[model samples]
Target chain A: DTAVSQTPKYLVTQMGNDKSIKCEQNLGHDTMYWYKQDSKKFLKIMFSYNNKELIINETVPNRFSPKSPDKAHLNLHINSLELGDSAVYFCASSQAFTGIGEAFFGQGTRLTVV
Target chain B: SQQGEEDPQALSIQEGENATMNCSYKTSINNLQWYRQNSGRGLVHLILIRSNEREKHSGRLRVTLDTSKKSSSLLITASRAADTASYFCATGGGTSGSRLTFGEGTQLTVNP
Candidate 1:
Protein backbone atom coordinates (compact mmCIF):
# COMPACT_ATOMS: atom_id res chain seq x y z
CA ASP A 1 0.00 0.00 0.00
CA THR A 2 1.22 3.45 -0.82
CA ALA A 3 1.80 5.34 2.38
CA VAL A 4 1.25 8.70 0.75
CA SER A 5 -0.55 9.36 -2.52
CA GLN A 6 -1.42 12.49 -4.52
CA THR A 7 -3.69 12.59 -7.52
CA PRO A 8 -2.98 14.11 -10.92
CA LYS A 9 0.70 13.23 -11.01
CA TYR A 10 1.04 15.70 -13.90
CA LEU A 11 -0.93 18.85 -14.64
CA VAL A 12 -0.71 21.08 -17.67
CA THR A 13 -2.84 24.20 -17.87
CA GLN A 14 -2.86 27.62 -19.41
CA MET A 15 -2.21 30.79 -17.49
CA GLY A 16 -5.17 32.14 -15.47
CA ASN A 17 -6.70 28.65 -15.32
CA ASP A 18 -7.52 27.25 -11.94
CA LYS A 19 -6.52 23.74 -10.82
CA SER A 20 -6.43 21.60 -7.75
CA ILE A 21 -4.19 18.82 -6.51
CA LYS A 22 -5.51 16.29 -4.02
CA CYS A 23 -3.36 14.50 -1.49
CA GLU A 24 -4.00 11.66 0.95
CA GLN A 25 -1.84 9.81 3.40
CA ASN A 26 -2.42 6.47 5.10
CA LEU A 27 0.55 6.75 7.43
CA GLY A 28 -1.72 7.72 10.35
CA HIS A 29 0.11 10.96 10.76
CA ASP A 30 -1.09 14.08 12.52
CA THR A 31 0.71 16.63 10.42
CA MET A 32 0.79 17.14 6.65
CA TYR A 33 2.58 19.64 4.40
CA TRP A 34 2.67 20.97 0.85
CA TYR A 35 6.02 21.85 -0.69
CA LYS A 36 7.05 23.38 -4.00
CA GLN A 37 10.26 22.52 -5.86
CA ASP A 38 11.27 24.96 -8.55
CA SER A 39 13.40 24.50 -11.69
CA LYS A 40 16.55 24.84 -9.60
CA LYS A 41 15.33 21.98 -7.39
CA PHE A 42 14.93 24.32 -4.43
CA LEU A 43 12.24 23.05 -2.13
CA LYS A 44 10.10 25.42 -0.07
CA ILE A 45 7.26 24.83 2.31
CA MET A 46 3.93 26.33 1.34
CA PHE A 47 1.43 25.19 3.91
CA SER A 48 1.04 22.85 6.84
CA TYR A 49 -2.00 21.32 8.48
CA ASN A 50 -2.20 19.43 11.71
CA ASN A 51 -5.28 17.36 12.50
CA LYS A 52 -7.26 19.26 9.89
CA GLU A 53 -6.31 22.62 11.34
CA LEU A 54 -4.12 25.14 9.60
CA ILE A 55 -0.87 25.43 11.48
CA ILE A 56 1.64 26.93 9.09
CA ASN A 57 0.93 29.32 6.28
CA GLU A 58 4.03 30.64 4.61
CA THR A 59 4.41 33.77 2.53
CA VAL A 60 2.62 32.10 -0.34
CA PRO A 61 0.51 34.14 -2.67
CA ASN A 62 -3.23 34.46 -2.03
CA ARG A 63 -4.00 32.41 -5.13
CA PHE A 64 -2.89 29.21 -3.43
CA SER A 65 -5.29 27.88 -0.83
CA PRO A 66 -5.06 24.61 1.07
CA LYS A 67 -8.01 22.80 2.58
CA SER A 68 -7.89 19.80 4.82
CA PRO A 69 -11.24 18.11 5.13
CA ASP A 70 -9.84 15.58 7.56
CA LYS A 71 -6.56 14.36 8.90
CA ALA A 72 -6.00 11.98 6.02
CA HIS A 73 -6.64 14.39 3.15
CA LEU A 74 -5.29 17.81 2.24
CA ASN A 75 -5.93 19.43 -1.10
CA LEU A 76 -4.36 22.48 -2.74
CA HIS A 77 -6.37 24.80 -4.94
CA ILE A 78 -4.75 27.53 -6.94
CA ASN A 79 -6.76 30.33 -8.44
CA SER A 80 -5.56 32.42 -11.33
CA LEU A 81 -2.49 30.33 -11.80
CA GLU A 82 0.51 32.08 -13.27
CA LEU A 83 3.63 31.02 -15.08
CA GLY A 84 5.68 31.37 -11.93
CA ASP A 85 3.56 28.67 -10.34
CA SER A 86 4.99 26.03 -12.64
CA ALA A 87 6.87 23.59 -10.49
CA VAL A 88 6.71 20.17 -8.85
CA TYR A 89 4.49 20.10 -5.76
CA PHE A 90 4.91 17.41 -3.17
CA CYS A 91 2.67 16.37 -0.28
CA ALA A 92 4.24 14.91 2.81
CA SER A 93 3.19 13.69 6.25
CA SER A 94 4.95 13.32 9.52
CA GLN A 95 4.04 11.86 12.88
CA ALA A 96 3.38 15.12 14.71
CA PHE A 97 3.38 18.86 14.48
CA THR A 98 6.69 19.15 16.29
CA GLY A 99 8.42 18.24 13.03
CA ILE A 100 11.07 16.22 14.80
CA GLY A 101 10.48 12.98 12.89
CA GLU A 102 10.99 11.73 9.38
CA ALA A 103 8.31 12.42 6.79
CA PHE A 104 6.79 10.32 4.01
CA PHE A 105 6.26 11.99 0.65
CA GLY A 106 4.07 11.25 -2.32
CA GLN A 107 5.34 10.83 -5.85
CA GLY A 108 4.65 14.60 -6.45
CA THR A 109 2.59 16.53 -8.97
CA ARG A 110 4.38 18.32 -11.79
CA LEU A 111 2.46 21.45 -12.68
CA THR A 112 3.13 23.36 -15.88
CA VAL A 113 1.41 26.63 -16.58
CA VAL A 114 1.94 28.00 -20.05
CA SER B 1 13.99 31.98 3.48
CA GLN B 2 15.93 28.71 3.49
CA GLN B 3 17.54 27.71 6.75
CA GLY B 4 20.02 25.14 5.53
CA GLU B 5 22.65 25.43 2.83
CA GLU B 6 24.43 22.37 1.46
CA ASP B 7 28.09 22.54 0.44
CA PRO B 8 29.47 21.35 -2.90
CA GLN B 9 26.37 21.79 -4.96
CA ALA B 10 27.35 18.72 -7.01
CA LEU B 11 29.62 15.72 -6.65
CA SER B 12 30.62 12.92 -9.01
CA ILE B 13 32.13 9.71 -7.72
CA GLN B 14 32.97 6.23 -8.93
CA GLU B 15 31.19 3.16 -7.69
CA GLY B 16 32.43 1.66 -4.40
CA GLU B 17 33.73 5.03 -3.25
CA ASN B 18 32.47 6.99 -0.30
CA ALA B 19 30.38 10.12 -0.83
CA THR B 20 30.10 12.86 1.73
CA MET B 21 27.76 15.86 1.87
CA ASN B 22 27.68 18.65 4.43
CA CYS B 23 24.89 20.94 5.56
CA SER B 24 24.91 24.19 7.53
CA TYR B 25 21.90 25.83 9.09
CA LYS B 26 21.19 29.33 10.35
CA THR B 27 19.10 28.73 13.47
CA SER B 28 18.92 26.18 16.25
CA ILE B 29 16.96 23.05 15.48
CA ASN B 30 15.62 20.12 17.35
CA ASN B 31 16.63 17.68 14.67
CA LEU B 32 18.09 17.40 11.21
CA GLN B 33 17.23 14.95 8.42
CA TRP B 34 18.62 13.79 5.10
CA TYR B 35 16.43 13.09 2.10
CA ARG B 36 17.11 11.73 -1.38
CA GLN B 37 15.16 12.48 -4.52
CA ASN B 38 15.57 10.73 -7.83
CA SER B 39 14.89 12.46 -11.06
CA GLY B 40 11.16 13.17 -11.45
CA ARG B 41 10.36 11.80 -8.00
CA GLY B 42 9.50 13.12 -4.58
CA LEU B 43 11.93 13.33 -1.71
CA VAL B 44 12.55 10.16 0.31
CA HIS B 45 13.57 10.29 3.95
CA LEU B 46 16.99 8.75 4.43
CA ILE B 47 18.21 9.38 8.00
CA LEU B 48 17.65 11.80 10.86
CA ILE B 49 19.77 12.87 13.80
CA ARG B 50 18.40 14.68 16.79
CA SER B 51 19.94 17.68 18.54
CA ASN B 52 21.02 15.58 21.49
CA GLU B 53 22.49 12.86 19.36
CA ARG B 54 25.96 13.21 17.87
CA GLU B 55 25.83 10.50 15.20
CA LYS B 56 23.61 7.78 13.83
CA HIS B 57 24.08 4.82 11.50
CA SER B 58 21.57 3.19 9.26
CA GLY B 59 22.76 0.53 6.86
CA ARG B 60 25.43 2.13 4.68
CA LEU B 61 24.38 5.69 5.61
CA ARG B 62 25.90 7.59 8.49
CA VAL B 63 24.64 10.95 9.78
CA THR B 64 26.38 13.31 12.16
CA LEU B 65 24.91 16.41 13.77
CA ASP B 66 26.73 19.25 15.54
CA THR B 67 24.39 21.64 17.27
CA SER B 68 27.26 23.78 18.43
CA LYS B 69 28.24 24.54 14.88
CA LYS B 70 24.69 24.29 13.55
CA SER B 71 25.81 21.85 10.93
CA SER B 72 25.38 18.23 9.88
CA SER B 73 26.99 15.76 7.53
CA LEU B 74 25.85 12.62 5.74
CA LEU B 75 28.26 9.89 4.68
CA ILE B 76 27.37 7.17 2.23
CA THR B 77 29.85 4.30 2.24
CA ALA B 78 30.39 2.13 -0.80
CA SER B 79 28.15 4.22 -2.95
CA ARG B 80 26.62 2.61 -6.01
CA ALA B 81 25.07 3.88 -9.18
CA ALA B 82 21.70 3.33 -7.63
CA ASP B 83 22.65 5.89 -5.00
CA THR B 84 23.04 8.56 -7.63
CA ALA B 85 20.46 11.18 -6.82
CA SER B 86 19.93 14.63 -5.33
CA TYR B 87 20.44 14.58 -1.59
CA PHE B 88 18.88 17.29 0.56
CA CYS B 89 19.39 18.28 4.14
CA ALA B 90 16.40 19.58 6.07
CA THR B 91 16.24 21.24 9.46
CA GLY B 92 13.21 20.89 11.72
CA GLY B 93 12.03 22.71 14.82
CA GLY B 94 12.59 26.35 15.81
CA THR B 95 9.99 29.10 15.46
CA SER B 96 9.09 28.22 11.90
CA GLY B 97 5.77 26.61 12.79
CA SER B 98 7.23 23.11 12.83
CA ARG B 99 7.97 23.10 9.14
CA LEU B 100 11.07 21.36 7.87
CA THR B 101 13.34 23.78 6.01
CA PHE B 102 15.20 22.18 3.11
CA GLY B 103 18.50 23.15 1.57
CA GLU B 104 19.30 23.63 -2.11
CA GLY B 105 20.37 19.95 -2.32
CA THR B 106 23.50 18.21 -3.52
CA GLN B 107 23.46 16.40 -6.83
CA LEU B 108 25.51 13.23 -6.50
CA THR B 109 26.34 11.20 -9.57
CA VAL B 110 27.90 7.79 -9.15
CA ASN B 111 29.54 6.37 -12.25
CA PRO B 112 29.25 2.66 -12.77
Candidate 2:
Protein backbone atom coordinates (compact mmCIF):
# COMPACT_ATOMS: atom_id res chain seq x y z
CA ASP A 1 0.00 0.00 0.00
CA THR A 2 1.17 3.48 -0.79
CA ALA A 3 2.00 5.23 2.45
CA VAL A 4 1.27 8.62 1.02
CA SER A 5 -0.61 9.44 -2.20
CA GLN A 6 -1.56 12.63 -4.02
CA THR A 7 -4.05 12.89 -6.82
CA PRO A 8 -3.50 14.26 -10.36
CA LYS A 9 0.20 13.56 -10.73
CA TYR A 10 0.18 16.05 -13.59
CA LEU A 11 -1.91 19.22 -13.84
CA VAL A 12 -2.03 21.76 -16.64
CA THR A 13 -4.32 24.75 -16.41
CA GLN A 14 -4.51 28.30 -17.65
CA MET A 15 -3.75 31.29 -15.49
CA GLY A 16 -6.50 32.69 -13.28
CA ASN A 17 -8.04 29.23 -13.06
CA ASP A 18 -8.77 27.44 -9.80
CA LYS A 19 -7.55 23.95 -8.97
CA SER A 20 -7.29 21.58 -6.06
CA ILE A 21 -4.90 18.73 -5.28
CA LYS A 22 -5.84 16.05 -2.80
CA CYS A 23 -3.42 14.16 -0.57
CA GLU A 24 -3.88 11.24 1.77
CA GLN A 25 -1.52 9.26 3.96
CA ASN A 26 -2.19 5.86 5.50
CA LEU A 27 0.89 5.76 7.70
CA GLY A 28 -1.16 6.95 10.64
CA HIS A 29 0.93 10.06 10.93
CA ASP A 30 -0.22 13.07 12.89
CA THR A 31 1.56 15.79 10.97
CA MET A 32 1.07 16.55 7.26
CA TYR A 33 2.78 19.14 5.08
CA TRP A 34 2.61 20.79 1.65
CA TYR A 35 5.79 21.68 -0.16
CA LYS A 36 6.55 23.44 -3.42
CA GLN A 37 9.52 22.56 -5.57
CA ASP A 38 10.57 25.06 -8.18
CA SER A 39 12.48 24.47 -11.42
CA LYS A 40 15.75 24.77 -9.55
CA LYS A 41 14.69 21.89 -7.29
CA PHE A 42 14.35 24.14 -4.25
CA LEU A 43 11.76 22.71 -1.94
CA LYS A 44 9.85 25.13 0.30
CA ILE A 45 7.32 24.28 2.88
CA MET A 46 3.95 26.00 2.39
CA PHE A 47 1.76 24.61 5.10
CA SER A 48 1.79 22.11 7.94
CA TYR A 49 -0.97 20.51 9.94
CA ASN A 50 -0.84 18.36 13.00
CA ASN A 51 -3.86 16.40 14.13
CA LYS A 52 -6.11 18.47 11.84
CA GLU A 53 -4.86 21.76 13.33
CA LEU A 54 -2.88 24.27 11.37
CA ILE A 55 0.56 24.63 12.92
CA ILE A 56 2.91 26.18 10.45
CA ASN A 57 1.87 28.42 7.56
CA GLU A 58 4.74 29.89 5.62
CA THR A 59 4.81 33.16 3.72
CA VAL A 60 2.86 31.70 0.84
CA PRO A 61 0.37 33.77 -1.08
CA ASN A 62 -3.15 33.81 0.26
CA ARG A 63 -4.29 32.18 -2.97
CA PHE A 64 -2.97 28.90 -1.70
CA SER A 65 -5.10 27.31 0.98
CA PRO A 66 -4.57 23.95 2.68
CA LYS A 67 -7.41 21.99 4.19
CA SER A 68 -7.06 18.99 6.42
CA PRO A 69 -10.28 17.12 7.02
CA ASP A 70 -8.56 14.55 9.18
CA LYS A 71 -5.10 13.73 10.40
CA ALA A 72 -4.54 11.36 7.49
CA HIS A 73 -5.68 13.74 4.73
CA LEU A 74 -4.52 17.20 3.74
CA ASN A 75 -5.60 18.93 0.55
CA LEU A 76 -4.43 22.07 -1.21
CA HIS A 77 -6.73 24.42 -3.09
CA ILE A 78 -5.52 27.27 -5.20
CA ASN A 79 -7.75 30.17 -6.08
CA SER A 80 -6.96 32.35 -9.08
CA LEU A 81 -3.75 30.55 -9.78
CA GLU A 82 -1.04 32.67 -11.37
CA LEU A 83 1.67 31.83 -13.82
CA GLY A 84 4.24 31.90 -11.06
CA ASP A 85 2.46 28.99 -9.47
CA SER A 86 3.79 26.56 -12.02
CA ALA A 87 5.81 24.06 -10.03
CA VAL A 88 5.71 20.59 -8.50
CA TYR A 89 3.70 20.20 -5.31
CA PHE A 90 4.62 17.56 -2.77
CA CYS A 91 2.66 16.21 0.17
CA ALA A 92 4.43 14.73 3.15
CA SER A 93 3.60 13.27 6.53
CA SER A 94 5.49 12.60 9.71
CA GLN A 95 4.76 10.71 12.88
CA ALA A 96 4.56 13.86 14.99
CA PHE A 97 4.78 17.61 14.93
CA THR A 98 8.41 17.39 15.94
CA GLY A 99 10.79 17.40 13.02
CA ILE A 100 12.96 14.65 14.46
CA GLY A 101 11.10 11.88 12.62
CA GLU A 102 11.51 10.94 9.00
CA ALA A 103 8.78 12.05 6.64
CA PHE A 104 7.00 10.06 3.95
CA PHE A 105 6.29 11.93 0.76
CA GLY A 106 3.88 11.45 -2.09
CA GLN A 107 4.91 11.04 -5.70
CA GLY A 108 4.21 14.79 -6.20
CA THR A 109 1.86 16.75 -8.48
CA ARG A 110 3.42 18.72 -11.28
CA LEU A 111 1.35 21.84 -11.95
CA THR A 112 1.92 23.81 -15.10
CA VAL A 113 0.20 27.14 -15.44
CA VAL A 114 -0.11 28.37 -18.97
CA SER B 1 15.10 31.72 3.24
CA GLN B 2 16.54 28.19 3.29
CA GLN B 3 18.27 27.16 6.47
CA GLY B 4 20.68 24.77 4.80
CA GLU B 5 22.92 25.25 1.78
CA GLU B 6 24.51 22.36 -0.08
CA ASP B 7 27.92 22.66 -1.67
CA PRO B 8 28.80 21.51 -5.20
CA GLN B 9 25.40 22.10 -6.70
CA ALA B 10 25.99 19.11 -8.96
CA LEU B 11 28.36 16.16 -9.10
CA SER B 12 28.97 13.59 -11.83
CA ILE B 13 30.85 10.37 -11.21
CA GLN B 14 31.35 7.03 -12.88
CA GLU B 15 29.84 3.85 -11.56
CA GLY B 16 31.77 2.10 -8.75
CA GLU B 17 33.12 5.46 -7.61
CA ASN B 18 32.18 7.21 -4.40
CA ALA B 19 30.14 10.43 -4.27
CA THR B 20 30.13 12.98 -1.49
CA MET B 21 27.85 15.98 -0.88
CA ASN B 22 28.14 18.55 1.87
CA CYS B 23 25.54 20.77 3.53
CA SER B 24 25.81 23.73 5.89
CA TYR B 25 23.13 25.34 7.95
CA LYS B 26 22.83 28.71 9.64
CA THR B 27 21.08 27.81 12.90
CA SER B 28 21.19 25.19 15.56
CA ILE B 29 19.19 22.08 14.81
CA ASN B 30 17.83 19.20 16.76
CA ASN B 31 18.38 16.74 13.96
CA LEU B 32 19.51 16.52 10.36
CA GLN B 33 18.10 14.33 7.61
CA TRP B 34 19.08 13.38 4.10
CA TYR B 35 16.72 12.64 1.25
CA ARG B 36 17.03 11.51 -2.35
CA GLN B 37 14.72 12.30 -5.24
CA ASN B 38 14.87 10.76 -8.63
CA SER B 39 13.61 12.75 -11.58
CA GLY B 40 9.84 13.12 -11.47
CA ARG B 41 9.63 11.52 -8.06
CA GLY B 42 9.12 12.73 -4.51
CA LEU B 43 11.90 12.97 -1.96
CA VAL B 44 12.64 9.73 -0.12
CA HIS B 45 14.15 9.59 3.32
CA LEU B 46 17.70 8.22 3.15
CA ILE B 47 18.95 8.65 6.71
CA LEU B 48 18.78 10.95 9.70
CA ILE B 49 21.27 11.92 12.43
CA ARG B 50 20.33 13.60 15.64
CA SER B 51 22.13 16.51 17.25
CA ASN B 52 23.73 14.18 19.77
CA GLU B 53 24.83 11.76 17.07
CA ARG B 54 27.81 12.27 14.81
CA GLU B 55 27.55 9.53 12.18
CA LYS B 56 24.97 7.16 10.78
CA HIS B 57 25.05 4.44 8.16
CA SER B 58 22.35 2.87 6.06
CA GLY B 59 23.50 0.29 3.57
CA ARG B 60 25.80 2.15 1.13
CA LEU B 61 24.89 5.58 2.49
CA ARG B 62 26.91 7.26 5.24
CA VAL B 63 25.79 10.45 6.96
CA THR B 64 27.85 12.59 9.32
CA LEU B 65 26.59 15.51 11.32
CA ASP B 66 28.65 18.13 13.16
CA THR B 67 26.46 20.29 15.35
CA SER B 68 29.33 22.52 16.37
CA LYS B 69 29.92 23.53 12.78
CA LYS B 70 26.25 23.20 11.81
CA SER B 71 27.06 21.08 8.79
CA SER B 72 26.57 17.56 7.49
CA SER B 73 27.85 15.34 4.72
CA LEU B 74 26.43 12.39 2.86
CA LEU B 75 28.72 9.83 1.26
CA ILE B 76 27.57 7.16 -1.12
CA THR B 77 29.96 4.24 -1.52
CA ALA B 78 30.35 2.49 -4.85
CA SER B 79 27.60 4.49 -6.47
CA ARG B 80 25.63 3.00 -9.36
CA ALA B 81 23.78 4.57 -12.21
CA ALA B 82 20.57 3.65 -10.45
CA ASP B 83 21.69 5.86 -7.56
CA THR B 84 21.78 8.93 -9.77
CA ALA B 85 19.42 11.47 -8.27
CA SER B 86 19.19 14.77 -6.45
CA TYR B 87 20.23 14.58 -2.82
CA PHE B 88 18.93 17.08 -0.28
CA CYS B 89 19.93 17.88 3.27
CA ALA B 90 17.26 19.12 5.65
CA THR B 91 17.67 20.69 9.06
CA GLY B 92 14.95 20.36 11.64
CA GLY B 93 14.02 22.11 14.88
CA GLY B 94 14.99 25.73 15.17
CA THR B 95 13.34 28.93 16.31
CA SER B 96 10.21 27.80 14.53
CA GLY B 97 10.41 24.62 16.60
CA SER B 98 8.56 22.53 14.04
CA ARG B 99 10.00 23.44 10.68
CA LEU B 100 12.03 21.01 8.59
CA THR B 101 13.84 23.18 6.08
CA PHE B 102 15.62 21.71 3.07
CA GLY B 103 18.69 22.87 1.24
CA GLU B 104 19.01 23.40 -2.48
CA GLY B 105 19.60 19.77 -3.48
CA THR B 106 22.78 18.48 -5.09
CA GLN B 107 22.20 16.76 -8.39
CA LEU B 108 24.28 13.58 -8.53
CA THR B 109 24.71 11.78 -11.83
CA VAL B 110 26.35 8.38 -11.66
CA ASN B 111 27.30 7.30 -15.17
CA PRO B 112 27.81 3.68 -16.06
TM-scores of the models, in the order given: 0.98, 0.98
lDDT of 1 by residue, B1-112 (tens): 8888998899999999999999999897888999999999989999988889999999999999988998999999999999999999999886544899999999999999
Could you tell me the TM-score of candidate 1? 0.98
Which clashing pairs does model 2 show? none
C-alpha lDDT of candidate 1 relative to the true structure: 0.94
lDDT of 2 by residue, B1-112 (tens): 8888998899999999999999999888888999999999999999989889999999999999988888999999999999999999998875547878999989999999
TM-score of chain B of 2: 0.97
Per-residue lDDT of candidate 1, residues A1-114 (tens digit): 999999899999999999999999998999999999999999999999999999889999999999999999999999999999999999999996884589899999999999
Q: Which candidate's lDDT is highest?
A: 1
Candidate 1 positional error at B99, Å: 0.7
Give fnat of each prediction, in order: 0.76, 0.76
Q: What lDDT does the true structure give each of the candidates?
A: 0.94, 0.93
- What TM-score between 0 and 1 does chain B of candidate 1 receive? 0.97
